[model samples]
Target: MSGIHLAYDLSFTHTEGRWNQPGAWVGSDFPDVKMFLELARTAERAGVDMLFFGDGSGIPSTWRGSIEPAVEWGIQWPRQDMSPIIAAMSTVTDHIGFGLTYSSTFMHPFYVARLLNSLDHVSGGRIAFNVVASSRGADAANYGYAQLADHDQRYERMEEFIAVCRALWDSVSPDAIERDRATGRFADPAKVHPIDHTGEFFTVKGPLSAVPSPQHHPVVVQAGNSPRGVAASATFADLVFGFGGSLAGQQRHRAMLDAALVDEGRDPAAVGILWATQVIVGRTAAEAITRRDTVLDFWTHEAVGTMLSHNAGYDFSTLPESFRLGELREEIIAANASPAGFIGALVTELGADTVITRDEFFEHGFLAASGLDHTVIGDAATVAETLEQNHADTGARGGFMLSSPLAMPSAYAELSELLVPELRRRGALAPRYPGSTLRENLAV
Candidate 1:
């Protein structure tokens, strides 16, 4: 890899815990074609490789078994479809790929394949489908499931899901598109083949109706930390979005993913693992700390608790402010298995007897407040140095997915003008986007 690949984890909802934060155009600017177009242009100019939009399928109803807190906090709700925004951005920017979050848990392979295949062609192959195996119960309910499938089984669903999509994408060969105007023939019928796939989770039939795009199939991106998730990524993902936190945690993730890839009969280096992180930059270290503090100040304990309650599938609001992990054993099992495991990990680190008060959990457990478990906060030089060194240490070729909690444009502005240039100078950032297509740029 020439340099670290950076992607903006694009948020469609108003950012920051508070809606009225300065520079927030929550009601007006969201889903605005022009606003996203400008954002895409700015990121592309900054040598950002992709605009990866994170999405959820349903409104969060897990918190207190109510959607009020999620709606009140704007915690990943009021969701807008990313397809239109991606289409608009693709028209204006040539090199910035669009990574769209679509769940394998809910959607059929044929639908996903057709939608992305068309998008890839329209975007000149600057598109990636960020495959997610849906986790939330509310999301499952919307998709006709009484509850989310068992964790390992969900990954099995994902494995079959991607297999069907790949088969559909490959159904029509690249050479199938002949476009012979003289003969009034747009494609070669002989080159098209039916997928006819019937798996345990899904039954997808026939060749895709659409022709193949530049990349054939848009880059497959997966972000699952479970063992089954690693296997799914190893089998299908071109790029893996990793959970960011400790150097050790990420290293372990990469090691397992690499091992999984080898087990799947693929080269370890062929896939990319991108860490999901936040960049808090300032002109000076103190300034960066101040900025980070300001962002933290916006997160209220209740807001964070509500977010966590939705994520873990247990009502934090119902628990006492001071509760021990042992007290919630039954509730923990009732919650999602992955989050229960996360709690177990935290207990192992902090001692299971460790009391997890609502205040602490609120302050540190909410993803945005938690900085997705890892955050880089410093002056431009320090931030660049930390990111470079960590990337070097983690052995992740696909780099950081940058975002800010404050919904401030200035953070990104500083990144473009200060931090990104510093990384480039250190030979850690790509000098320019390598090519017009996402695959080409990522291949660099």
Candidate 2:
């Protein structure tokens, strides 16, 4: 085995009251470049592979048709572009790569390709693009849509989006530029050619008007939980972001992806799935549990509802006193919202025929929204053991994308300073920065 690769998820560093939690930045705040600068240096020192930022452009307004609950509670709201953040982080560190997400459903292929191309240059070939199909109605509304694009249709658009990007990236050959200072000659015109692309969703013309980035094309990362989503990942993703909440689910996802990769005529061994895991590691077991308790006690009913609604793209606040699980799932599906989150799980677990009360639904929603049910909380040794067991239990292909419920620097510090070192001491980690670019290092 080549060993495991790890990345830190900075997607929710300052949100959900994390800024008020212990070990959060005292002087600096969210969007403050200084805190991130320190984090980049720390991450590089620890030999962490990547720092990832998942993005959602719109504020949460799906809960009760208002964004108040999310705004007041800071639930997944107040996010920055992170492109600039990655650029800043790259200047202060080397070796460690950066991953940032963009929506293929909402964004133009040419723009996204050009932007990532430049970012790959800025990061010295360390940039990875996590392309997503937008599902949230709030996100769609921001892009001048009343609701989301149909689920499968979004994936179709994503395919074309990627096709256009690939063509643009390849349009300019890596050796096209000729910087002969003595002759004063420019790029070779023959090497730089136009890509005339017309597809179902997008029509992009041209070779990208920029020098080839360090890697030429940024590493592609995708996270699609559904069968269709998995198929899409097999098509283009260099790395896959998967949910690490359940061992059975993780194993299932791995199996499905392996099959898909084979079907795509790609080597399954070359692709890896970085399980998205929430962690609350500490110096000791007792300390970890105490932090977990803090997490358990953090969410209010409104906050929980807002997060659940925003993510699933369904308003849970409007649920009646009691309803059939199947009916609720069907309603969400009819509305074109995702039928695969909290409600989907309920239907799966308790049977679609089961009747569940609103209170019982929220009871589940609390755990679902806070992500406590899926989180791994323990000291370094215990956490390491759990991870190793999980890695083996699954395929041990990719490692983990660790996110924190506690405040930034504090929770992140525990993973980098404590958990990661433990993993390294146990010889469970892959080589550190073994390759020049993200594609080389992260591609299993």
- List TM-score per model, in order: 0.92, 0.97
Q: Number of the top candidate by lDDT? A: 2
lDDT of 2 by residue, 1-444 (tens): 768899999999999989989788898899999889998998888999999999999999999999888888888979989999899999999899999999998999999999999999988999999999987998898899977878888889998898899889999999999998999998889999989887888877798988889988788899987888989999988899998676877888899999999999999888888888888898899999988887766798988889999888889889999999999888887887777756766676688999989999999888788887578889999999998888888887898999989988778877889999999999999988889888788764
**Candidate 2 clashing pairs, residues 3+ apart or interchain:** none
Instruction: Please list all clashing residue pairs in model 1, or write none if there are none.
Output: none
lDDT of 1 by residue, 77-109 (tens): 777878988988888987889999898888888
10 residues in a row with least lDDT, candidate 2: 340-349
RMSD of each: 2.6, 1.3
Candidate 1 wrongly placed segments (more than 4 Å): 25-27, 320-337, 340-348, 351-363, 366-372
Q: Residue 103 error for model 1, in Å?
A: 0.7
